[model samples]
Target: MRLRVCGICIQNERILLINHSLYGKDTFFWSPPGGGVQFGETATEALEREFLEETGLRVKVGKLLFINEHIEAPLHAVEMFFQIDSFEGTLKTGEDPELSAEGQVIEQVQFLSWDELTQFAPNQLHRIFSMIGSLDGVFHLQNYIPGQNSGLEK
Candidate 1:
């Protein structure tokens, strides 16, 4: 199993997300602007690089948020999700080529409020969303299968 790390940047009740095309299918999934941790680089360092490379913004790494163990076929990865605060530069789009592991092109880089995010595809990583509401310090997400439903708060 490999280890990965990402950062969740939340500001003004909205979170920063990137639109990605996975496996040739255009899925507007929600994910924090972060990437895998390098061999020797710390999570903060990797996040800093990833944020800049993906969103063209500099971020100040904050507290650790969630830890997800994803078993998506041959790829079994343990992900460390963190909270990031402070950044520079106006958010833009398309940091790199679309749909690359190195990092997907920032097709859309906008802040979506929790309420507004419900309008998007359901099962779009709602564990993190729930965590936000419940204030669950850390989470362990497993067997995540995306589906259709309004993942909004009642």
Candidate 2:
């Protein structure tokens, strides 16, 4: 499993997210700005870099919101979700350097309101978001398990 750090950035009642299509596969994922933590880099450092690369925003990482053990065949990540205390930059679609130009997964970058998120199926979104009743509940998350964030169980 890999360790990943994701930033929860909220501004003006909307949240930053990326529309990512898996390379060489017919799948799409809507998730926050985040990625694998590189060796020697702190989790906050990784989150900061990831936010800039994925959302075109420079962010200051805040408190740890929750920890999630994401489990899907072929991918299992121990993800750390942290609050983005602040940010500054024009929002824009960004690229994932890990993928080839032709296989880039990032399809769009957007700031979406809570209601906007409900339109997508739980499986289409990151598990952390798939379960929340309100955006404010995101800040209350602490430790997350497999089914807890998927609305299958608490």
Candidate 3:
């Protein structure tokens, strides 16, 4: 099972996202710049690496925001979302090659205004953004029953 942690690097009313070009998809789905936790790295470390690689910024991860369990995602896809409060550096695309993930190279790496964020796929993220105030109540644990199936028969 693989464990990954990502952070929503929000600044100046805009959020950081990557435009992925994998699986033959032409359009982009918005996601925070984050990736899998390595064998020995902590969640904060992984986030710092991913952010630097993808967005070219040094981030200060603040608090754990959400933990998502996706039955439909690939194997062992547990994601932790965090609140990043502070950072240093100019935001750009693919400034750190070492931090790039598979199929994730910075193309349009700038802060997207709130209105701009709506022009992406998976509309639920919009609600996710609105619900940021209730961050503590947003995390849902799915299909954790020991014997029973998760019932995520999608």
- Best candidate, lDDT: 2
Q: How well is each residue in 1-154 modelled by candidate 1, as lDDT tens digits?
A: 6776777776776778876554335655667776677788988898888888778888898877657665555456677777776888878774653345565545677787766765665555534564444222223333332322344332
Descending-lDDT candidate ranking: 2, 1, 3
- What's the TM-score of each model vs. the native? 0.73, 0.89, 0.70
lDDT (Cα) of model 3: 0.63
Query: Please, what's the RMSD in Å of model 1?
Result: 7.2
Residues 64-142 of candidate 3 have per-residue lDDT tens digits of 8667644443344667778888989987776435445554444556666667764554542423444343323234322
Off by over 4 Å in 3: 73-75, 95-106, 123-154
How big is the positional error of residue 34 in model 1, measured in Å on the Cα after superposition?
Answer: 1.0
Give a tens-digit lDDT track for model 2, residues 1-154: 7999988888889988888886335777789889999999999999999988888888889999888897665566899999999999988888888878897888889988999999988878887775678788788887775533333232
Task: Show the lowest summed lDDT stretch of 10 residues, model 3.
Answer: 140-149
Cα error of candidate 3 at position 63, Å: 0.8
